[model samples]
Target: IIIGEKRLRQQSKDPRTPPSHQPEADITPSPSPRPRPPDNLEEGEVEEVCEISTPPSEVLVVEGQADEPFSTDHAQRLIGQIMVWNGQIDRMRDQIDSMRKRLDTMQQEIKNMIDVLGRI
Candidate 1:
């Protein structure tokens, strides 16, 4: 992305200025240089290099469109929802534990009553 930004900035230069005169940092090296024709070759044999850089104006438009929602209000709302869900989960776990304890106590009481009746 940074390289693309640099290329876009380079392409925004004035048309009158030659690339050779541009600042060194603004230039990016190509993967491979095009092979030059022999000196004796005719002018028609030489290939024209096509510039493929994106315009800086278009880059600005794209960057503007990619801006995301990162406001504090949005973050706070998400955090609040998470906290509410967490609290509800904790309450549910406590209720389950309380019910288990009550069940265990009832079973013990029933066993005690059965033993007492058998002895009688």
Candidate 2:
């Protein structure tokens, strides 16, 4: 029985036997190479090329103040708004907790009333 099984395995492994049917894989051609900058560009030349590429109006110049982008007044207003919203959220959470406690107490009372009526 082992010899017969070995013969069947050898027959299955034969290269002359046709392969199982399978869909052919799609073969796509490789994309073309991208253009690159020349290797011999100097530091100054590179900076000049970048400056030429960018428009002047898009560039920002901050002369006097380092933190001009975020003024103290704007920061204070944002902090005030955050504090007000935080207080409102705390109040809403407290109200929800109280409502849940009331609901639980009412449910317990109704259960007790039902038990008393059942006893009667």
Candidate 3:
């Protein structure tokens, strides 16, 4: 919840500014290249890539999940679980949309307040 609140604070800092008004640099993602070692490194020393481009090349997991022998009961349970997860995802999406609308309304109100103040 703390992390989420921090993200919300950062997002609302400039809620009055629409995405289109934001600079291209701020909207675009920055490239992440592996960092290079300094030239002052010792002659025999070697520097590894500071960035992890990919996870371990391969992961061998024995019996990652023991699959139960095919059974109608298992299939039904799996389907029910999937349905539950889908419903949860849909609810979260709806909540996010609702929050975005509220944010937009607040931004509009702020803009109106500024306009009214300007007229004074």
Candidate 4:
């Protein structure tokens, strides 16, 4: 009888049972609590899983388009883009000026040829 009573008590204390599958039994402390679905838990009774809080970003927020809050990196990126555009525009202007000068030279040569032909 004594041996049988001891066996029953050992079984009860063994954590392999249904309700004792807790992470605490594993003995390593988790940085964050595990999350669980809210069911029959009392309003004030906090579960071990629900005790940890998550970061603000992890919490859900509704969609709304606020003016894009610009950061320094974004501003720097914008400035870089503007500089690239300005360089391209300056290159195009230089090309157009070169083309205009060539056209003017060609026109003067044609006028000189016409005058020489008239003299001939």
Query: Looking at model 1, which ten-residue stretch has the lowest summed lDDT?
Result: 1-10
Quote each prediction's TM-score. 0.39, 0.41, 0.43, 0.42
lDDT (0 to 1) per candidate = 0.61, 0.55, 0.55, 0.55
Considering only N, C-alpha and C atoms within 3 Å, which residue pairs clash in candidate 1?
A: none
* Candidate 2: residue 12 Cα off by (Å): 71
Q: What is the lDDT of residue 32 in candidate 1?
A: 62
Give the per-residue lDDT of model 2 (tens digit) for 46-107.
Answer: 42221112233232333353433456798799999999999999999999999999999999
For candidate 1, the per-residue lDDT at 19 reads 33
| Model 3 pairs in collision | none
Q: Tens-digit lDDT track for model 1 on 17-69?
A: 53332332344655566555668878667455454555534322233332342
Model 1: number of clashes?
0
lDDT by residue (tens digit), candidate 4, 2-39: 11111111112334543222122122355455446478
| TM-score between model 2 and native | 0.41
Estimate candidate 4's alpha-carbon lDDT, on a 0 to 1 scale: 0.55
Q: Which stretches of candidate 1 lie over 4 Å from their true place?
A: 1-71
Rank all candidate structures by their lDDT, best first, as comma-separated numbers: 1, 3, 4, 2
Question: What is the alpha-carbon lDDT of model 1 when measured against the actual structure?
Answer: 0.61
